[model samples]
Target: MDTNSKIKRLTILITCIILSTISYGQTSIKNINLKAGKYKVGFKHYTINDCTRTYRIHNDFNNQLIERPIPISIWYPSKIENNSSKQLTVLNYLEILKEEEEWNDLPNYFLLDWFPYLWNTPENKAHLSEKVTAFSNSYFLIGNFPVIVYAPSYQASSIENFALFEYLASNGFVIISSPSRGTETRWLEGGSSKDMETQSRDVEVLLKEINKYENIDVDRIALMGFSFGGLSNVITVMKNKNVSAIVSLDGTERYNYAILEKSPFFNLEKFSVPYIHFAQKEIPEEVLNSDKIPAELNYKFQLYDSLKYSEAYSFRFHDLSHSYFSSFGVLFANRDQRQDKSDDKIMVSYKLMSEHTLQFLNAVLKNEKNAKEYIENSPVKNGFSESLFSKKMKQAVTKEFDYKDFNDLALDQGYQNLIPLYKRTIAIHPNLELQEGMLNTLGLRLSFNPKKLEQGVNVFLLALYIYPKSANLYDSLAEGYFYNNDFENAISNYKKSLVLNPENQNAINRLKQLQE
Candidate 1:
């Protein structure tokens, strides 16, 4: 052969070798060895169009406004007979992916190539037939289970993290997820602040969607996200009060705090839930320089640093990179050999991530004692080496005893002992004040409801004690008594109101009517 031809053949051989090794040692879901909990896992897929928002299919011949399509994937604890033949396979999840990606007609043969992430390798092909824990069309378990509403990574499928969802469901939790899509279309606007809000809103829709499920314990809820989904979830947690905990899997909130801050609802105080963030290993200097990624990303987490009201736990899994946080990424994503760890190490770290997520959820949502200790303790104590995984936990700085806390105490005792509760709360939280306006509105709302008249009177009484000289409180208290047929007390409060404000015409009229 000529010298030039010999050189060309050598180059081709090297290129083929590099390409072959890029996704070496790909793993199956079974190889992950996630021990299933006592409950059987059930899978359900359904679509709900959000009527409030309009969407467009960019590929349509004539673009038109239509209700935003939200494809939901739910995994919950089930009691169905364990029929292996009926269980969902990896292919089933990717089929859902095909529908969600706006290519509903895309043939199964082209699935791997159509999406850049899923490689068509021998190991990846094997995964398609593997039976996951979840059985499709299975009946949900009888009892109410805690919920975890998941948001997928940027423009990803709802079932991107199916393995984790199945594991959670097997442990008696309900996992709801929708694809991360643009505000108006299937594609995002280059991962902008708008994208974050859109995904956050999608998560909120799931929050409302949870209401339909009779088996869900709405009070016990958590938000889990990967990559950009992580950033979106922070805003979700801020805007929502129902979320009790949040889990981030190598979330972008750490790398892109500015995008998270751009949200109007962004407030550190609102993130007062039990939070756990599992971060990828520090990007090697070579990759950082080559990829133009900022080195500050490895250490600077403004959100984690600013959080003072959450029992925050931050962990670094040394063997995993950002992609491995999701099941699809671990099993199919082409590894960046420059920064990606070996396949064995990645699998181990993923299992670690899954366990930690379970422990954190158990601690905050299920209130499991052992899980709480597992989350609070050091990585060494959790049976992992410091070199492989490291942890940092910050106890929630005692949250302020706000009026809501005081009200909860008052509510528990039927609003009878509010005055004593207020006094007790004041001793602990010196600055705590039951705002006269809040008390007035609350009292009026309750007083108008005949069933809650007594509770309303109690609220007004507490208000009067706080604002002794206020005519409004006296007038409101009189109205409460009037509504309850307590004429003598009504006349007394009307007179008190007149004493505070002689020009109080309502009080004057009320007192005249009572005297007559």
Candidate 2:
């Protein structure tokens, strides 16, 4: 063959090879279509009748005997038909809102009218009741779904993050959340490991209580948390052998706390259950250090290895803020129309984080094959490079003109065709704002497609540049580097992560093993 012919043949060969490589790397994750519905369990409200208990006050006050009441609301899958319009936990709602406003430094006005879309009435009381009831009514049943025990943040009641509790409850999982004593006031002051241990014991007691009910698979239990709650879940899962898995959503890193004289690293070896740590982009560096985190948890399986069970799967969304991982954030953001999409970063973070959490839970708790496949092969599960985001964004923009016609066609195709159109719409939108529905679609695609990993990483890195002191970003970069076999780079990034978070055991151990 002539030189030009040979060159053409070689070009085609290289193109095919690259395309094949991309195809081999990609994995598909299915969208979890949770139908909206309402269901309630017949819970007999009863307070824990402990007549006298010694309580310690924070103001150097003496221990006093007091009666502590556990007002419980049990929500289980029931055959009762008249439970549709039941009002949400009103007393709990008011108390939680008051506490959240102070903890998050949010204004009272924003908290009063959280979801404007759901509000429509002259009587504010009725509107609030309807809004909450509607939320409670929308339940998604994952037939025989595993149990997830949620530990609340320090000095924060279980009801404080009702949005998250409601969402999880609606998504087919039975969530058991409780407010520990001293958990409703001065959160930061009471964020102690001892408090977390006590909360874990509370979970154990709650689980025993739940056994009295029907249809709960006690063996398949997972522990999860948000913020200080995340730290609590970690300690809980580590201490409790009954817990099959542990999940952390923007949890406090133990690194900063590890340096304290009363650190909670006593039983690191007892923690053998799988852990899924979903970090926000704005986590402080003080929480990412290796020395601060227990050394055992730093192994590749628990740190950088995504394929193994008894592993740690960590991800950091570049634009995700600390408060974005819970439903309370959505209500907070919707309160102000002038606020940009960036303000709802927590909502976006929750959507993505929830999908992964569900997947991880399925893999560990239910032993779902499809979920495991998605976790092993998906870009989100493995590691995406930082270069692919711009490419995907550009591709999305280029296809915008065709979106209108596609939507019109979809309208005639029984709305099923609109799913693709909706996916394209997300790609086409240039606002960089993350909508929950749109994010759910794109995130599923990103998780499954290895070709998109580079793009996802690129987008995340761009986000990191905007928020540099982010421990999550460093952790993500370290994961990407480990996947790419750039162990040195991964180690360096992990070290940087440690500088920001001195207690990240996973990062430290991974670095040590890789160095060895």
Candidate 3:
């Protein structure tokens, strides 16, 4: 063979090997199948006067009447005979408004007659809409499952931002989405807090109304919310004990604090239900810091405490903004002429965030024990520990806490026992700063005692405080929270790390597992 030919053949062989390895490593989640399509769902719209008018009533900034419309869309697995086929169109009213405002240079209220029909376009037909159609259509369905109560953002419309909803429904989760009435349009216009109380009550009433539907496992009901909607879920679950679990997508902690203190879920001592918080890394610092405010004076602070009882997980995307978790964020960032740059970094972050959110829902809501491994043992980039002990030692000690102890203690005792050592290490080496050597030492320990998770979490948090910008630290903290059964906190901390480093496959895999 000629020299050039041999060289070309070798290059081709190398490329093939690389591609094969990539494909092998990029395996999707097992036992779960997802396909894009639409399904017919039974839905009902109602207006309720039972709850107070606006949210954040005490805030002088939100002084407005509570009267507004409430619309609810419920989805359940149905026999073909029970319902007709329908095309689904996922709409984002907020995105539409932003687009119209930018394109036409008109007031935000300038209504576009073509807005509703836009989903009918060939390019957008794959999306799911709440509206029904005359013909039966292909709808994605994983397996027959019970019902899930879904809450939309305070101002979002029905079928708005179906990214999360459709993914869940297609993967066997029945969803009921409640839209904020007049609040959708004015929410970003400085009127969101006004009708929150009414919004929460509306969600509860919808749950009661949805009970009339056939084949719904009301006892297995779970609450899933996004952004403002997530805040509503926090409120709804606090008032209604029937909710089994909750999944919040980048939901702020401020609203949770408010409801936990003055609203019905105030007595955290009384509630012990499992919950998951799926937050984005770019969550406003103000919201996370809400807990720092005095609980007596800040209603949101109380809600932060309530989060302690739930399994929390945060998905961080270094290249993503606060709105990235929602479909609107994806669409908005992808648009042309917008200064916001969307690249491979943003796309990967979105995927990672979505996957983690699903993994969490599966573990906490569906009670899938195997799913826990994703959070428990999954490795973040650079050999960062997925447990707390490694994190604490990485932050505090000049040398790594020997894994000999980790494996020995984890097997003999439990993760809880390691907390004191981690705490003491932090106290003793207050001046310790994270370094490559420390990380390597911690990695060695984690390799042996991966289950000594609490100590790993403490170490990770301490490392985070010292190296606040380290994505590895945040990922470790997230893993710490996950093993601790604090899914909400796990999601929150993971998000912080992701925001700093989105390409971390370890974080992405763990996030996907949590979401599933």
Candidate 4:
């Protein structure tokens, strides 16, 4: 690029900064000029109730399920309330440490216990919660908007990443977040994996409720979790197909925990979607705590490599620690000599984190061609060198389902000629989980195109061949048959499904509908 091009790009960014400042009213927040978006933002809370789960750690024994109140916080585009609306109060570690359990009762044996010593005694953040561009419970903007469900790191508040949430919301996305609840960092007695599993389950319940909102487009949803929260997010999205993308910020480091005892299948097996993980530079082996590196990091590396059929991106920022991923990191910095990095440095990293995240999520969820180009073409951002970046497009070889290639054929020509392709693909890449994701996408696409009902049936039939005993596939095939107006085949497949798995009430109900 020429000097003129460089000058033009800088001018555009500077203009954006100035306009954002003008709209949001210049902030009193020091050392940061974080950019806002096109729309004024609004924030509100949704208190979720009727959650029944009995954890052994809550008491000594697991009993009947009890109601749990999970509070979900939301940020969205709204009519500007006034120029003076301050950003919400920020939550700090000390307050979180006092939430439910006594401070002494929390674990202290870990290496992290020493790190907390570096924090300046938590001060009241009210003075620090300066100007930002958002309203308090303003009327939401009309139209169905894309959604981002965020998960905070262990022991952190949902408000930990408020900067990112508000920014994404300002850019016209619905952002939802919830407290970690049972899995909170207040106590580590509840195993890391167990807490994550609890949070993961909470995410499912939260998304179900978020979908009920009138303005949210259920089809476009993404999951983002910072630090250990990323682990929870990866776990949730692997189970919930409704999530279309994921952004993990310095997320891979949490793989050090073995809550699931190294069994990747439960959390990693079906990772066939658009996922990007931004990480801090790797720690030197000499400086590593143990004599060896954690096994889980290697597992994640293997999984990233195996995400051959998905749009996978991984990058390591030149100089950043794990905490730099969220806004809280900046507030926590420079507390003591032991923590020498200044808040301004972390703020720089956090700003980029917020910016890149919005861009990446925009690329996948909104299908913006230029956003994808920006991600692929511009790997390194100015000042902060993106030390390492890699993107794996699904290899088009056989036995492995090439999602991009197969999706093209399915949409352009139809699923009629796709079975042979899948057969060869499955033969080469015989991962049941990946195959399941492909089939599910095919089923969803088929449902949208009612005229392609028979094609849907054929696709499900191919899946049945791959997973012959899967009751769910039979039911899906039955639905496809019914959609095509083939009542007889529909009933037959539903009966087959019921015979294989008697508990599928959905299949039973569909069967009754056909019979009646």
Candidate 5:
């Protein structure tokens, strides 16, 4: 060959090898394939009222309706109608997110210094969202699909769980998620517990709003939450009988358990729903010491132990943290924080979790015969191990604590008469997350009633007993007493509240009027 031709041949061979490597890398992410399901997916958003109550979520003790809107993101099976949406690349989501005002703080979470390295690696960057997303503004599929209403983790946006949500929606499920204002955990300051009610009520309002549209199988609804969202699932199921099942993704009810003096919304004796819990296995050498091990991990063991009910299953995945459960969580966190677990390994674990969640839904919602075994019988893979668990009963059971049962009591005997049940329920379960909210609602609801003024005073007194440190609760009590014409008692409560917090302006203002 001529010298020029020989040089060209060598260059061609090297170019082909580089292209082949890049192709292999692009084809898979981590070690798992996150390709979209058989059906095309559609996306939409709904801004709904917070709940059944006329009052919005952020209202203060005065019951003045402070309007806080809830923005919900929904995904569903879609037809092949073309529009403006192009098949997305992973980089596209990055660009879209950067332009979003709400997502401005997002890039800080993703270690930007490593972005160039990840960008250059075709395997990590190629065809990720391409395997997901759909035509913008596409209509929902004609037939009814089972619904999955999701609650995001602490301060987590609906977009954080986008990959998982898209997977379920494309697989013939209608999945929706809300920002769950007030209870975003970041908002849970001053040791306040009222946000638990706000979260459930927010979820309830979002579902009711979404169900007004077509293609939703309301009967097959399931509540799923990651981390603290798990506790949300627990509390929401108690109030709504329509929810068929619950999935907790390493749910952070453990953290809540650490701070709970007692539970007002939970009852071990009343445990009945079919549920599945995926727990990050306790760290090595921690043993079973409650003090030594993190309270969050220990609480899961507490819940699973005391919370034996029908068709409940628990699995433990070793070498995982609370963060790896979500794909976006992995992508956003500092890569160095992942303990050197490759993206592929993390992806594999996510696949297992998602598949098991699907199996759980099949077993409970669709009556699939072998779905239980598929989950409980799962063997250890990539440091994932299943904890031996037995179904609570041979068959699934109905809800144990019905909202109608409590509502009937509140409506029939008067709100004050319902106190015994709250006290008794908390007596049995100390992790009742919504105790404060429930009591506040009870006290304030009756306080405004002309016939129930004394009842309001009684309920407010009870709330004070439960939350002694809460200046707001004391302020609420004083207002209730003042309205009931019990000026002496009202003055006493105002003084007590001032002792706790001298700068309680509302209480201070009301106390001056009562004295005059």
Candidate 6:
């Protein structure tokens, strides 16, 4: 080989290596710069066993019916007095990852190379030393703060989205989460419907777990999830009524509506909470074709399209792919050269996503006026370029006011002043009715209770007013007065009942007894 030819080949090889290094460079977590809110963030992690569900430890030879181990990671608003030495570093969160991933004894040094998604690189090594915002076991702020129950991506750690959790906690929101695992083991059955259901149950456990904290506002809770976790959260919202709102970070609910539909609990009518979904950029044609992904996936969102009763917000970030939706993904996942955006663009979009999440939570959970305005405004109005972002929102459909709705109103005021309440409600709903049967049964039930006899009489009066000349309503009214020991009113109602129905046997017997 000639020396000149060898030198030319060497130059070309060096050029290719330099270009490849630039193309595959990793993102530094510091570049994200997620702004913290007014409150100090506190983080705590512990494990509780769900004894109701049996689980098998794959490593155990006996495979006994041990309780399902749920490892909980929580971030919440805290008092400002935190020991600087105990402030959590990124490595602390990775320790939680080890425990939840069943690698409890793995040496901390090998974490980067041990996980397939976490590359062993100098940039990633720097992340381990970077200090996060949360302080370990800091005193909780003394107030009822809204909570968010998070479900992690497929078989992922509860602390997977630590950055967002801290961001939300610093804004006075309590975030609780557990790892996503299979029904019977630490691994899932290939993301099947059964896997979806198992993850949903885990989220419900977190829902009940929040009640233990006195500072948590149980009345106002939201569910947030990433990837497969998103699918589980949607099912959780459908099966449970307590969730006030839900936030999805590039959630699979957009891509796998079929899996959701398979769950018996999935009824669109039950999914009426305020919901927001932040999506990934459209996959490039080359990537789509090479990856064998369906082109319709770029446009089809059956769940969003089919929804009719939720205040839904959908945003597509042109700069983010699905993996970047999570803190762990942003820091650890490898960038696909065919479709991944530049690290700078990805970090900027992540900051925007976090801000949008805060505003949405404030608008729905706290009912903040400014937050509502911010959420309702378009992306361009909020200062983002239209080419980089797009949004679509759906206002919930107005449901009809039915008898059950009226009954709730009646029950709230102890059934007193129903006539006036009905008058006001009917004037507005014109179609609303307090059914004769429901009122009669309600009156009888109340009358039988000695302490509620007067309320029963009030209910009877309302029933008669609505069903004016009905023999049954008058008889029920007579019964209510008789139960209350008001002989004069009881006699007057019995006579009216007899007038309405000459053969009213119950009214006849009651009147004769009263006379005797």
The number of the candidate with the highest lDDT is 1
All candidates in order of TM-score, best leading: 6, 1, 4, 5, 2, 3
**For residues 41-112, could you state the per-residue lDDT of candidate 1 as single tens digits?**
889899999999999987674679899999999999987765542787899889997779888899998997
| Cα lDDT, all candidates | 0.85, 0.49, 0.48, 0.62, 0.60, 0.84
Model 2 C-alpha lDDT per residue in residues 1-516, reported as the tens digit of each score: 543333233222211111111101110011112222355432222345233333333333445434433444344443433556344543336544443222334443454455221232232333233334222343333356567777655444555445544445544567766655443222233345565555555666676666754567788888877666665565565556688888877565422234122445434445567776665453233332311323222222222221232565566565554444554433332222111234334344455566667777878888999886665554533454432111110001122334344435444653343344445655766443333333233323442355554543443444354457766667666766677666787798799989998888879888888978
lDDT of 4 by residue, 1-516 (tens): 543333233222211111111111111234455677887788876566644654323432445344565666788887755564444544322333332222434443221333331233323233244555556747778878899888876655666667778888889899888766564323433324666677787788778877678999999999988766676787787778788998888663234333433334354546667888886645444423232333234225544555544677776654455556766555543222222234555556567667778888889999998787766655543333544333333331233445665666566766676668666766766662436767866775685477777677767767777688988888877777777777898899889999999999999898777778
Q: State, as a TM-score between 0 and 1, how close model 5 is to the true structure.
A: 0.59
> The CA-based lDDT of model 2 is what?
0.49
How does model 6 score by TM-score?
Answer: 0.90
Cα RMSD (Å) between model 5 and the true structure?
Answer: 16.7
Please give, for residues 260-327, the per-residue lDDT of candidate 3 as tens digits: 34454445543445555543333234532432322222222234343444544433344454444555
Query: Alpha-carbon error at 168 in model 6, in Å?
Result: 1.3
Give a tens-digit lDDT track for model 5, residues 411-438. Answer: 6666555567667765665554346667
Model 1: which residue pairs collide?
Answer: none
List pairs with backbone clashes in candidate 4.
Answer: 155-185, 399-424, 399-425, 399-428, 399-429, 400-425, 400-429
The better-scoring model by TM-score among 3 and 5 is 5
Relative to the true structure, candidate 1 reaches a TM of 0.89
TM-score (C-alpha) between model 3 and the true structure: 0.48
Q: Report the Cα lDDT for candidate 4.
A: 0.62
- Model 4, which residues run further than 4 Å from truth? 1-30, 55-66, 82-129, 183-191, 252-254, 257-269, 284-300, 333-340, 378-516
Q: How does model 3 fare in lDDT?
A: 0.48
| lDDT string, candidate 6, 342-435, tens digits | 8889888988898899999999999999999999999878887987779999899977889988888888999899899989999999988678
TM-score of each: 0.89, 0.50, 0.48, 0.63, 0.59, 0.90
Q: Give RMSD to native, each candidate.
A: 7.3, 27.0, 24.3, 13.6, 16.7, 8.7
